[model samples]
Target: MKRKRVVCGFGLGLLLLGTGYVSAQSPNIVIIYADDLGYGEVKALNPERCKLETPAIDSLARDGMVFTDGHSSSAVCTPSRYSMLTGRYSWRSKLQKGVLNPWGENLLNPERITMPELVRTKGYLTAAIGKWHLGWDWQKRDGSYVFDEPVRGGPVDHGYDYYFGPDVPDFPPFAWIENDRLTAMPTENSKPDPRGGRGGPLVPGWDPEAMLSTMAGKAADYFDERASDKNPFFLYFGLTSPHTPIVPSKAWQGKSGMGAYCDFVLETDHTVGQVLQALEKSGLDQNTLVFFSSDNGCSSGPSKSIKLAKELGHYTSGKLRGHKGSNFEGGTRVPFIVRWPGVVPAGSVCDQMVCQIDYMATVADVLGIEMPASAGVDSISFLPLLKEPQAAPPRETLILHNYYGEFALRDGPYKLILAPGNGQGFGGGPSDAEAIQRGDPMVQLYNLGDDVAETTNLANIHPERVQLMTEKLVSSVARGRTTPGKPLRNDAEIDLYKKHLHKGK
Candidate 1:
């Protein structure tokens, strides 16, 4: 372990050169992004309340920093994944709402550079395992998933040396890909998820049951193989479990007693343990930067909504007003746990509002690499905050976007929503009723510091503040960029999204 920890010789020399920018002892970066885990889902975050055990995740938080107000760029998978990888807002692209279908053309533009690409330029073997919700072109000719469609715009095209998992569950050719080649060919084209297996159909050649374990095994293997390797690695392990189909392995079944949803979460927690175990076993734990977070809030399921309501008498979105798919605090706010051994303080909690979108520039900054103007437009380097929670975020105003491009920009205590409809979506029960009074207009405003649930609409009283944030959201949309860095391409991909997206359907 001692030999594995390379001493950092921090010098301007690495920074002066265009490539290897991070410290010589640059830690391997691993981002474990859960699909729909909620803000207060982790037991440590809400010890007195949260029902989910997640000891593995709890141990992870104890090892490093835990963020209270972390959010995904988008509430849903595709958009959120797109924003995380590109460091740009999904609204900047054409896919305005919901998510992409498995059969749809890819969402990422082939020409646009990505985070893995940025890091790879500085000598990192970037690999993305597990679920890839961002769209990818697969299987069009002679049973070949590639099909001359030019798998150019995705992680492979960007910077990752390897790729895996379904282009999302329901998407066609539902199988893992190793460097653009499918591990199992879609001998039969998968159909729109018919009845159940969580969300996607139990398609041929695709056993959703084994996916969680399979992915974890592969990740562990990858880490073991890379332990002795010289070049630092950036691995993005995006898990599909705890997302949908709610199917956990038989051993994990009934363990949660909250039904499939909680069972799947337990399975996800085990997967986290597997990852951390691999790092420790390989002597890579100390030098590896491990981050665990979710793309969005918890999904509305029998466990969290019905079963939990019957038993706990409430939902798992915790104190948040709504669940996944809404702009409410639950939808976008998520758990963010980062572990970097000695660099980050253990058991520390940071209340700063940060998003996965900042990772592009933040990782680059930590690595000491110069981000080309073409990359990381919306990404602010949160490198300083990683080691020091008191350090200010690079950006004062952090934005939260719902599934349908409903925008919420937060500047300190004040948060301004661009549109109406309660910002929680048109729904039933208490939340929607409160929204009715506002009539869903005039750019509702609230002091998140005061009203975390956003119960009071201060729009009438805070007109000037509303106007300012509205303008900011509109201007950001107009610019079609998110980060403050330069556009990766002087000529941004005119075709930001692929045709045949779910919208067309």
Candidate 2:
């Protein structure tokens, strides 16, 4: 597959500058976000433990920079999405735990400065295609759910020029939404799903089988349309596959010898390949900055059971500790790959601590734009590390969030968990009560540099370190913003270390 490369013919001029300033030409930005994808799922990231193949995603790592310590702000999809777009911690909002229901109100306030909104300021076209788990303003006709009526507070309302795909995969109203309107009115109720959440008011022919393929084709079409456009475009392609309902298309079924889950993961990789090929075919590859990452860790759903994965000799979390919905490294740590011709170095690996929330600031840094203090309060630009892999990480302290109240704070290599538990929502982990009854420390601590799997607890031995981290977490919460600035007010009262310990005791 030959690709048309674009050269600005200023290589010598750029070399003379000495400073690594980004080119004045606005580059196309494409973000491919996967749902519930584990760090170990990418073969390049987990060469020794990952049995499933992922050539498309691995190719990005080969041609670009791979961050070994990249993470999402939360262990679930909704909050992570919120943090990625708004550059603020989801915990700062009222949604302290769990994801939003499909019919619920939109959590992304319209007033906030979203990633797309910021990009649009530079006159770029923005589009969001695929699963939008974030809530929207649903329409009702005569007190009954109306499908064709425009839904507010969605992609369009949040700054996307175009919006397409299902609102949520396993949630109600399993039908496609083009812009603010549904393609077809959902008239039939879906059968109850025991393993995954059931869909509501689905259209008669809603098939999970064709969902991913259709979305991929639409994304390809989007690239084709924007190929010759005057302004650079930004496409947020959120993939829903390999998350739940574990339905691998016929072409990918049994492709991976592991199981249905592995097969679905392969299909996801294939989808990424298709999108990349589309960009190349449309002559948009060279001027595009491609980013690939997951919303969170691999889900420990029934279809992707831990026992079954272990039996198949596959470790979804690789050498990390927990799965999705936990505060452990495995739950929040994810695969991050970025490629930009003549900008990012090829085959470079960065061990910098970064989070999805930093996307806004990094984008601003790339464009040489300064963000207001009120926006992206928790975001720190990793742009320097991207240009110089040996440069130290911009962010030194990070806070990890879970659906439960168990929060972990990381300062350099040491991490302090406010509570004791696996931080998972399911599949055989100690409950808070169980940990307390077993004489487990009210708090847990570990040095991730020495123990990536979080096997050792150094809280009892290093009370001073634990106390210091606990105080930092408290100060961060009270200040309402992680980055330097005037302390902002949280949307609601936050649950911090002291409160958690008092309740546990």
Candidate 3:
């Protein structure tokens, strides 16, 4: 593919070039974010050990640049999503622990600029289609949700011109939501699933099995509508498959003989193919920049089914340690592929560190716009890497957090985990309580360059290094933003080593 260089100058505060300037040649951007997908789940990322096939995702790797050291900002869903959109750590927000509750208040502050909102300044039409795990302000009466009125503070309010998908696939009001209103008010309550997930008001005869296909179809329809439009579009296609309530349609049930989770993985790949096919069908493939990644690592199903899958020969996290909700490489390290014809070199691989939070700044660079000082404070543009795969890495250090709010600092190859055990999720590591009782070291350190699996703890061997990294982590949290800028205030007080502070030190 021929390289197309985009030339533009940058200045501070919201498209400083001019208020009327719009890039006539800006490429359409599509971000396909998978839910709970592990690093090795994609066949191309771990061909030797991975059991399942992901042709659509693999094609993205073959067509563009694949980052071996890519990661989500957090080891869980909501925080990672927040960071991806806002270019700031979720820990800086009030949500320090788990995800947003169903029908909870919007986690995004109204004053903050989102990816969609930023792109709108460049005259791009933005749409968020698929699982929006972010909160919604559902009208409630006496603690119960009332769906008669439109919900507030959703994708539309956060910069998206169009929005569709369930607030959460497994959460209440199990029906389709377009823009701010439910497609059909739930007239009945859903029964509890035998697998897991809470039951709540549901649309009558809503088929969980068909959910993935419906989202794909909607995305394809969206592409068809925007194909001929003059202005470029930004589509955040967040997939809901391969997560909880793991339901693979009947056609894909036995496609992967491993199990339901594997089957769902296959179906998720097909969903990617559907979106790609739609883009191609609409004649937008050559001009669209597409990103494919996951929110976090694979979930260890109930009864250690993922462990059983590993025993049977499917290494979800590949050679990495821990699973979802851990500070280990496996939990946050994810499959990241970017495809942009005439820009990103095909079949190129980069081993430099990159995080999802950098998306906001990268998009800003691509559109030839400079973000305000307050926005994308943690984001460093990787646009140079996309243009020149051999360019020096834009980021050298990163802060990783798990579902439990445990902090981990990564500087070069050395990783410092403040907490002892493998933080939450299903990796079967020692729990905080168990580690405390066993008198395990409070701090865990590993050189990823030497210990990708994180099997050996080097904290005792290198106390000085641990102290240095710990101080760096503290400074990062205290300063609010990671990148160079005016220090901002965190929405909540941040204690880097909350529970295991005294024990570890």
Best by lDDT: 3
lDDT of 1 at 264: 82
Ranked by TM-score from best down, the candidates are 2, 3, 1
- lDDT string for model 2 (228-319, tens) is 66578889999987787777889888888777788999999999999999988998898788889998888877436476456876788888
lDDT preference between candidates 2 and 3, better one: 3
What are the runs in model 3 whose C-alpha is more than 4 Å off? 1-24, 302-306, 424-427, 500-505
Clashing pairs in 2: 172-200, 326-423
Once model 1 is optimally superposed onto the true structure by TM-score, how far is the C-alpha of residue 218 displaced, in angstroms? 0.4
Q: Per-residue lDDT for 1-505 in model 1, tens only?
A: 0011122323332232343245457779999998888765678776656777888998988877887788888777888888889887776676766788655667877666788988887688989988776765544466544532445445676678887766564444556666665654345654445323323323365777788888888888888889867668999999886776666888898997767777888898899898889878988887888888898887765244645755774356767766677677777888888888766677777777788998888787777778777666777876666646777665777776665556678788788765544333421123333445635443568888888888888899878887787777656655656555433332233322112221210
Residues 116-194 of candidate 3 have per-residue lDDT tens digits of 9999997889999999988987777898787878889899999999999987888888999999999998999977876
- Which parts of model 2 are misplaced by more than 4 Å? 1-20, 194-197, 303-305, 423-428, 497-505
Please give each candidate's TM-score.
0.86, 0.94, 0.93
- Evaluate all candidate structures by whole-model CA lDDT and list the values in order: 0.70, 0.82, 0.85
